[model samples]
Structure formats: structure tokens, C-alpha cells
Target: MTYTSRIDLSDHVRKQACALLQARLSDALDLEAQAKQAHWNVKGPHFLQLHQLFDSVHDEIEQFVDLLAERITTLGHVADGRITTTASATTLYGYPLEATGGEAHLKALAGSLGAFGKAVRVGIDQAGTIGDADTADLFTQISRETDKQLWFLEAHLQAH
Candidate 1:
């Protein structure tokens, strides 16, 4: 249910933007948890580097989670970020719990980051099409950061 707000957008537009934000919020929360999992479980020769990188990724995604949830509330909708909600709503592939090595965690995380980045890019366009430039800009900012984080993860997977 949408609460009354002084924001200029119509209920329809706000609802659409809130739905989009909610979906991304779920993904962000799931992604954050996956990063923490990698941080905690990573082993092998590159353990230190991989562990630090995974922690950093988790930190960044925590910010994204707050941003997405706040945006939903700003648009006058409740942001449901519970783990059960995220488990059910997230579009991201499940992180591999069996992944214990650097390469394994890296690959798993890169896949998730790639998927989240792709969805956020779509959200940028969707928000724009729905006439909410602010929401679109928020998505744009997130997409850029997600791409950078994906690059960091992919770099480790590269043989060079």
C-alpha cells in the first residue's frame, strides 16, 4: 500500500517506480549476502586478496541496499527487504555454497554482479520510460558502480 506523499508523481508512476526499486532491493540484499559468503568461505592461495575484495563488494552493496529501500519509501511505498522476501523475489542466481576456492567464489560473484548490473540497467531505462528521471538516475548510478565491481571480480578470473 502506498502512503500519501507530497511528491509530485502520480500514484501510478510512484507505484511503478516503487515496484522497480523493490525488485532491485531484493537483488541487492541477496548480492550482499553472497559477497559475505564469499568473504567468509574463500580459501586457496589468493585467499587474502579474495577475502578482502569480497568484503569490499559487500560494503558497496550494503550501500545499494539502503539506497534502493530509501527510494521505495520516498516514493511512498513500503520496502520489503526481509530475507524470505529476498529469497523469493530476487532474480539473481543462487550463490554456490560449495564454492570454497578463490576462483570458484570469484566466478560465482561475477555471475551475480553481472546479472544485477544487467537488471539495474534495465531499471534505468524503465524508470525513464515511466517519467521518473530521479529514479532513473539512481539506477544509472548503481549500474555504473555494479559494472566497476563486476570488473574487479572478472579481473581475478582472467588468466593475465
Candidate 2:
């Protein structure tokens, strides 16, 4: 698709931004699926709590997915968020299907969120490098929110 924008960014920069956003979209989609997997399969004493937390995390990730998709569209690129595309493009580690315990789910979730947050930090730098402040700020916002979610998941692992 041909994209013409008044955003002042060069074609190369816009393409870069779209690629970056699409990559994050894949990660967000994968993360949401993993959270749902954890929510459904989670068991043990803290099952209810962990199930609820996973749902909440999934919801937040859905919003992030929307943000990323919209950003890609704003750049005039087709946002390829299909499950197949996400499964192929995502950098997230596979969620352990054998993990049924709350602690196990929490550990997996925290690791995924940490990985995502790290990627967002890199995205922020990449957007900045292209002189796309709006995209950089978007990544910054995502990074902060992802870090907060990671903290929430990790808090369950922290000692008193």
C-alpha cells in the first residue's frame, strides 16, 4: 500500500516506525494469548487470584495491541496482527503448557512482561533515532506501562 503523510518523516523513517510497531503488536498479541493460557490453566491454592491477575494483564495487553495497530495505520502501513503473523514474529518465549500452578504462571508472565518492556525500551531508542518523537513517546508510554505490569506480576515473587 502506498502511504503519503504530512507527518514530515521520510519514507524510510515511516517504514521503520511501521515495522517497529508491527513487531511490538506481535509481541502484545502473543503476550495476551499467553496470559489467557495461564488464566485458564492456573490451579492450586492461589488459583483465583492468579487467574484474575492474568485476565487483567491480558486486558492491558489488548489495549497496547490496539495502540500499536493504530500507530501502524497512522503511518499508512497495513498492521499485520494475524495470529499466524504474531506467532512467527513474536520474540516472546513459548508459554509452558505444563505450568498449572500460580507461582509458575506468575514466573512465566513476569518474564514475558520483562522481555516486552525491554523491547519497548529499544523501540523508544529506535524511534528517537529516526527523529520520530511521537513514535518515541508512544514507545516510552508503553515501556512505562509494561514495566508497571511487570512489577505487578513480579511482586508476587518478591520476599517480604
Candidate 3:
């Protein structure tokens, strides 16, 4: 349900933006948990580096979670961030529970980041098409940061 708000955007636009934000929020929450899983389970020679990097990724995703949820509320919609909501709504492929090595976790996390980044890029265009420049800009900011995070994850997977 949407609440009454003073924002100039029409109810239709706000509802569309909120739905977009909610979907991304679920993905962000799932990604954050996956990062933490990697951080906790990573082993092998590069344990320290992988552990730190995963933790950093988790922290960054937490910010995205907050941003998406707040944008939903600002659009006058409830931000459904409960764990069950995320589990059911997230578009990301499930992170492997048995992934224990640094390389394994890195690949898994990178896949998730790539998927989320792609979705956020789509969200940017969708928001713009729906006539919400602010939401589009918000997705743009998220897409940029998500790309950087994916780069960091990919760097470890590269042989060079």
C-alpha cells in the first residue's frame, strides 16, 4: 500500500518507482548476505585478502540496501526488507552454501554482483522511462558503484 505524500510525482509514477526500488532492495539484501557468507567461509592462501575484500563488499552493499529502501519510503511505499521477503523476491542465484575456498567464494560473489549490476542498469532506464529522473539518477549512482565492486571481485579471478 502507498501512503499519501507531498512529492510532485503522481501516484502511478511513485508506485512504479517503489516497485522498482523494492525489487532492487531485495537483491541488495541478498547480495549483502552472500558477501558476509564469503567473508566468513573463505579459506586458502589468500584468506586474509579475500576475507577483507568480502567484508568491504558487504559494507558497501549495506549502503545500497539503505538507499533503495529509503527511496521506496520516500516514494510513499512500504519498504519490505524482511529476510523472508528478500529470500522470496531476490532475483540473484542462490550462493552456494558449501563454497569454502577463496576462489570459489570470489566467483560466486562476482556472479551475484554482476547480476545485480545488470538489474540496476535496467532500473535506471526504467525509472527514466517512467518519468522519475530522481529514481533514475539513484539507480545510476548504484549502477556505478556496483560496477566498481564487480571490478574488485573480478580482479581476484584474473590470472594477471
Per-residue alpha-carbon lDDT of model 1 for 88-135, expressed as tens digits?
999999998899889899999999999999999999999999999999
Candidate 1 structure lDDT = 0.95
Q: Rank the candidates by lDDT, best first.
A: 3, 1, 2
If scored against the real structure, what TM-score would every candidate get? 0.98, 0.96, 0.98
Summarize candidate 3's per-residue lDDT along 1-160 as a digit string, tens digits. 9899899999999999999999999999999999999999999999999999999999999999999999999988999999999999999999999999988999999999999999999999999999999999999999999999999999888975
Runs with alpha carbons beyond 4 Å of true place in candidate 3: none
Each model's Cα RMSD: 0.7, 1.1, 0.8
**lDDT for each of the candidates?**
0.95, 0.90, 0.96
Runs off by more than 4 Å, candidate 2:
none
**lDDT (10s digit) by residue, model 2, range 96-152:** 989878888999988898999999999999999987899999999989999988988
Residue 33 lDDT in candidate 2: 93
True lDDT of residue 57, candidate 2: 92
Span of ten consecutive residues with least summed lDDT in model 3: 151-160
Q: Each candidate: how many clashes?
A: 0, 0, 0
